[model samples]
Structure formats: C-alpha cells, structure tokens
Target: MDISDKATEREEQDRDIALHQRKPEGPAATGQCLYCEDPLPPGKRWCCTACRDDWEFIQK
Candidate 1:
C-alpha cells in the first residue's frame, strides 16, 4: 500500500488496541486471595499466580 494507506492502517490498529485495553477493576490490595479466600499480606490480590489466573478466568 502507499504511504497514506499504511498510515491509515496503523492508526486503525492503534485505535483497536486502545478500545480493547481495560483498566484493573476492584480493590488493589484485598489482603486475601480473590479466588480461594486464602490469607495474604497487604498489596496482594491472590496467594499465587494460579489463583490469579483462575480468578481472571472465572471473571470472564
């Protein structure tokens, strides 16, 4: 494609990415695992990565 067409395509791609991006929901630090309710320190959302993944999966 020509320079103008390529520029338009890039703009469209950027807009698509911006539209799909999402901000984190809920509290930043709940002091417990969101999925399993396991105890955790402050500033932690999940006890482990697995719990975090499961929480997100269930949310979807």
Candidate 2:
C-alpha cells in the first residue's frame, strides 16, 4: 500500500521479466534440412513433414 511496497513489487516484476528474457528460447536440435540443406534448429526444425522426410531420405 505504501511507496516502498509498490517499489518492491515493481522491482520484483522487473527481475522476473529480465529472468524470462534471459532464458533460453527453446530446446536445441542437431540435424540438417534436405531441400535447402541448411542447419536444423536454426532453420525452424525442417519447416514441414515434407522437409523432414526429405532430410531423412537424403541422409540415406
């Protein structure tokens, strides 16, 4: 209810936001695209089923 409480709450919220922002975006993957032949995780994980299957086929 007082200014100190409000400031503390704001500080906590800011810390939470910073923590989330610093967290890793998502899981990592190691693979390659077939058609484009680009890297995997960096390429949004193949884009589609076709791309994925194509990658598998190419691997063979």
Candidate 3:
C-alpha cells in the first residue's frame, strides 16, 4: 500500500482499538457490567473474564 493508504489503514485500526476500549459511560452504567449486568468497578465495561468473553463473542 502507498503511504496515504497505510496511514488511513492505521488510523482506522486505531479508531477500532479506541472503540473497543470505550466503556459504558453514564449514571445507569455505574457499577454495572455491560455484558452480564453484574456489579463491577465503577467505570468498567465487563466485570470479569466471563463477561469480557461474552461481550467479545457477541461482538464477533
């Protein structure tokens, strides 16, 4: 790929990574797991390994 193409690809990949790391942000999501609805660290997406796997499964 050309320089511009490679740059675009990298940018897209970075955006995807950022999106993947983004957590549920709101008062409602506070202390709740995004995947299993369990209590979690205040700003976390998945509460545990199981919840992370479940979310990754659904995403895929």
TM-score of each candidate structure, all chains considered together: 0.54, 0.38, 0.43
Best by lDDT: 1
Which pairs clash in model 1? Answer: none
Q: Report how far off residue 5 is in candidate 2 (Å).
A: 0.1
Clashing pairs in 3: none
* Candidate 3 lDDT, 1-60, residue by residue in tens: 499999999999999999977756423446788787887776576688887787778876
Models sorted by TM-score, best on top: 1, 3, 2
| lDDT of candidates 1 onward, in order | 0.83, 0.66, 0.75
Candidate order by decreasing lDDT? 1, 3, 2
Candidate 2: tens digits of C-alpha lDDT, residues 1-60: 499999999999999989955736433344655456577675355657787677667667
Runs off by more than 4 Å, candidate 1: 1-26
Better of 2 and 3 by lDDT: 3
Clashes of each: 0, 0, 0
By TM-score, the better pick of 1 and 3 is 1
